[model samples]
Target chain A: MQVCKKCLLNDNMPSVRINEDGLCNLCSTQYESRGIVNNNEEEISSLIKANREEKYQIILAYSGGKDSTYSLKMIKERYDASILAVTFDNGFLSDTCLKNIRTVTDNLDVDSIIIKYPAKKIIRAFKYIEDGKFFPRQSMERASAICNMCIMLIKNLIYYEAIIRRIPIICFGWTPGQVMTSKPLIKLNYTMVLKGFENIKNIITSRFGARYEKYFLDDAFMRENEANMPYLYYPFVKNNYKEDSVIEEIKEIGWIPPQNTDGNSSNCLLNSYANQCHVSKFGYHPYAFEISNLIREGYLTREEGLTKIGNVANPCSYKMICEQFEKITG
Target chain B: MNIQAVNEKLKEFFENNFLYGESFDDINGDESLIDKGYVDSIGIISLVAFIENAIGIKVYDSEIVPENFDSINSIYAYLKKKMNTQDKAV
Candidate 1:
């Protein structure tokens, strides 16, 4: 339970070493001196501006969360870019998030697409992860069970939509902590590495049948046309926007807080359950590194990050998650 | 650079950076670092960075495939080939 003095990382966190000064190795290691650039608003704005003249300028992977809602609003109002917002309904969305999605997109006057996976499919995927049949064991040190699979599916669908529509920019609401430090605007060629998930795809195909391939891998299209892929952009990661201000700005666009989700998440009901499972099995919160990154970058305070991740799952949500898991596994 | 020097350098980099200063003796040079739970996707990224900086070679997106990066032996072989190609071009 011993936490880092400088960041929210605890002693239980994998790959962390606490020094005599009570600072985690990540804090003491002079990561900034490694030559990774911090948030550069000018570079991000220029990238957005350069893409603005293109047709269907941005395809935002919108999750109806506060960060994405703010991103959607920013793309429309700030850059005046034509945007297509796509939401992947993973069968665990809060009602408020759904309402927020409809209200915000309607207000923004942007085209929106919702790709809803069947509840059974999502449950089955989770079951595989839960049974340790999916994902690399080392990955558990970084990501949650639901997140590893869910993000893969979302990214694939987004890439597919962007390629088909010839959208030049694929914007995500990823924070600085979520992305590699070298760049915020990644070339499409590099983003196509998701296609290399051969082991995960094989597992899904064997366990859940080949139907999962449609969602997880767009092999035919990717093979024939991956060269024509769009650039991946992370606006939130590049700009120094305060979280409170982002919430407030999105509130003007009809975004509301959900009652069912954990403090760290605003859209998905499954996040708390996922956090619970991650902590139970791995002895650390899956989001600890992400939250710690936020703290290190001064985006969030150490105490706030700790409080946000600590004991996020409630009994009611836990019961609901168990029931859903049972129905899907059966 | 000689293969022995390159191999020694790679071992040092992986041990110092990825393994958190742990000795590389426990890991096999030919075994899959990923399958052995020694590296993940993020670890691959860091390893790529280390190669570019420490080995003085640039890894392209196409070279990120498992054939080139799944194991210490694979990485050393890929580096040797790339270096030879660079030398020939010069």
Candidate 2:
């Protein structure tokens, strides 16, 4: 399939088109708007200082992924706030990922907490997914469909932990490319985000039984009070750094690639499967959404986006995913 | 018998639960919903749950589709019709 000349977008993607001059949806938006924007670093720095002046203990949603690692490092180096690095082991991380978590946490002098789901429940969840008999209707056409479920659970855990520890600022290392950083940090609206999860919970409850509801849902009162803070990606929205350079700079902070993983994944093996399934079903890798958004925002060019696509997912991973699915289902 | 009441209930449910963009105030009851940009396909399941929660109605898995949510008027009209049928069946 022909890729968009301007961004990582492919011609076959649903509802996306490249104009004759080769501008993708994202780049075209920027072109029409006259230019892109980069926020003032001094402003961001002053905001961080003002926010952290209370000596709040920062709860970092550490995924053991490179992005979160960079986030942890930034929060530690910049704010010098006491940081807690927490990872939710979804029962499928490669052995190397666990080792990297240890290495980075120790090097950064940050306290680490690792939470793992019960093996039986995770296996049952995996089997349910593999059976091809049950799937959440919302999962289609997205990369990380299964990972999304895991993330939802992890998010609830973080919120609960934040409340219990009285940690006011809950930080996750989401990059600008992942979710737009139009607004960096805002107080949580449990009602709005919670409502989105309700129907998805019904599907999960029906398939895996209602026993899992508490893990996937958060208390309303806590969400309304605690702050939701995200850092690394929004800065990129303003400065528009090359991913390679950011990855390189962070490597000096003792970041290392996990063994048996490719450039597309510096952290999770499950990501490869999710991306492959999304591409097979949707005719394009799911990363196209983020890449297209970045390109539209003038942070990256069409060629740059397409080049990065090769690094995010590999089709070959599908063979292993199919084998694993069959094994679980059997 | 509760069709109009059901419509009012669903409208209230949408406002209370659903978050729309800045243009939400411009939403008219009769316009095409997806065309008018109220919610995407992803919002449909949530809408189903909202109807179930508000109207105390049950919609089968097969009945979930664009036709049921094409417009606010359509959603209002459908809930009214379905709930009436349901009242009779009961």
Candidate 3:
């Protein structure tokens, strides 16, 4: 298969068109707009100062991963936003992740909320998606079905907290590749949002027995926050990430890389399982595009990017996936 | 230019940039991009930006609903109306 000369993306990936010059469609399109942009420091500080009336200015979706750990450190040290770190413990999180979470939050003196829904609840959602694609083809190319569901769940839960606490910003530490946008904040069109979220909510309603459908957001939540929609922030997108620098910098905050995860992940074991399913189903890694983008934008070396996607997922994660989803197989 | 030309251009952009399937000819212009899984949450945002940059019609947040932006045909119709209004105002 032909691969892009500029980045590591190959023709095997869906929606990829490799040019005669040996550049992939994604690389060609981004070539003109590629530049380093770490320009949101002032904006974040101003928002935090202005929104002091709210208990917390930002509710950062902390995944206890290296990227997020770096983001947490930057927010506290660089921007110094009044922040509350929130994590949804998607049952497959490494034990090391929990330790990192506790140590980092305690050291930073930031309050935190760690929500662990019953594993049965998350497993049903996983099984439901096994039957069909639950997201757009583009989104599916970016991440696995299981990872998509987990991210949606985390966003919904963090958004809920932001609305309740009157926080002005809901933050995530998405890398430039993961974010796919250079914008500092994501302006969510409500109609577009509901359209995106409706299916995930339905998955939850069906699996959680419809009785607790209220667990998902309803019109009441929308009505209450109409005038004050919390701004969805991707702070990490503004920073030009160098992966090694990020890992080394975040280590001072007690963040340790977990040995249990596959090469693609630092915190969640399910990520390995998800990558396995994605490759088997799609013929290429789910992160093929994102990793290529990282290489294109100089966040990682091509060799480093290749190594990240080359290694197979953790074997133990396959066993964990079987144990979790077997509950719903009947 | 006419709405047909505008539509052809939009289709070309999506085909060259984002479409995962074989050809735009197979897609019904009236089909909802969101409902059909052609575009997701972030994809919709990118679409709006493309519309603004391509046609100079700035879409506001309230106008991002299904009626105007759900399908390629709907986007065409909205563009026609908007361009007509802009011409009249001028």
Candidate 4:
């Protein structure tokens, strides 16, 4: 239960040690060695320029969240690159988020697609996480149940779209902490490591008696396109703009925060329940590491990060999540 | 490099970077580091980076299969083969 004085991470976090000065081992380690940097303007511009000649230059994993909305606006207006905005409708999107997605994409005049998965499949994935069978202990340090599976689906979809469209870049609205454990900008070859997820996939298949293979990029697809997989970019990770300023700017493009999401999410209604499930199992919100990363990077104050991870799930949201899962699973 | 040198270097890297300074007394040369809970997918990515930087070899996607990365022995063997191939090509 001991929290780091410097950030929101606690002793429960894997591989963490608090020092006499109250700084966690992660903070004390050679900061420069960490390679955590904000928006690399040169890299972003060069990537766009390098892919300028390609049709549909970028495939953005848009979620109608505030960060993603901002990213869509930037890719459209600032870079003026042709983009395909892809949203995976995980059957948990709030009404407000759907409207926001429509409004913002309409305003931006970008091509967009929504791929909705079966609610039963999503619930099955959740069942595995609820039972602590999906995510590795190290992964729990950064994200929760639904968030992890949702991200995997989104990334796979983006890779699928990018490969089919021959797009050279896949951009995300990921914050720094999300990319902290790995390089922010990675070659598509990194997908080779996804073989590791097969263990979790096997577990899900055994329990659900269903092959959710479509949710992941097949090895054949990766092998056929291995020579030309798109680069995965996290543009918002090191942006100089703070969250408040970005929210204010995106408002001009008709982006509005959802009423039903948890304190950490702007789009997914399932986040509140996922947070509750995560805390019940792990004794901490999965977002604690992400919020703490923001604090360490000076994007948020310590007090603000603490408040963001505080219990924000309401009874109505919890009841809705349970009812939806039961209806789908039954 | 010799296998002894490669083993020593990899043990040092894993202990320093991934193990949080914990020694590898329980780790076997042939056991799967990932299946044993010592590494995860993200850790594999970092290990790739470390190999590319520290060992000065690019790990192609085709080379990332489990046969090349499941354990200290596998990684050392992979690295030795890569270096030998590079030397011959040079």
Which portions of model 3 miss their true places by more than 4 Å?
A34-43, A203-208, A327-330, B1-9, B48-68, B74-90
Model 3 per-residue lDDT tens digits across residues A59-157: 899999998888888878876568899999988889999999999898888888899987776777777775237677778877888888788888778
Interface RMSD, Å, model 2 = 15.6
DockQ for all candidate structures vs. native: 0.21, 0.03, 0.34, 0.20
Residues A48-124 of candidate 2 have per-residue lDDT tens digits of 56557444467788887777787777768876466777898876566777887898888899988999887567656
| Top of the candidates by DockQ | 3
The superposed Cα distance between candidate 4 and the true structure at residue B45, in angstroms, equals: 4.4
For model 2, report DockQ.
0.03
- Winner by TM-score: 3
TM-score each candidate.
0.82, 0.67, 0.87, 0.83
List, residue by residue over A1-330, the lDDT tens digit for candidate 4: 778898888777665677888887666652333334334456656877887888788899999999899988877876757889999998888899999999999999998899998777778777666645556666666787677777777877888889888887788887765654334566635445456666666666676665677777777778777777777777775465477898899999888887767888898888888888888877777898788778887788998888888855756777899888877666
Checking candidate 3 for backbone clashes, the offending pairs are none
Q: What is the lDDT of residue A151 in candidate 2?
A: 63
Interface RMSD of each: 5.3, 15.6, 4.8, 5.4
Better of 2 and 3 by TM-score: 3
lDDT at position B9, candidate 2:
55
Whole-structure CA lDDT of model 4: 0.74
| Candidate 2 Cα errors over 4 Å, as ranges | A18-22, A31-56, A123-142, A219-239, A298-301, A311-321, B1-90
DockQ, Cα level, model 4: 0.20
The residue pairs found clashing in candidate 4 are A38-A238, A39-A238, A39-A239
Docking class of 3: acceptable
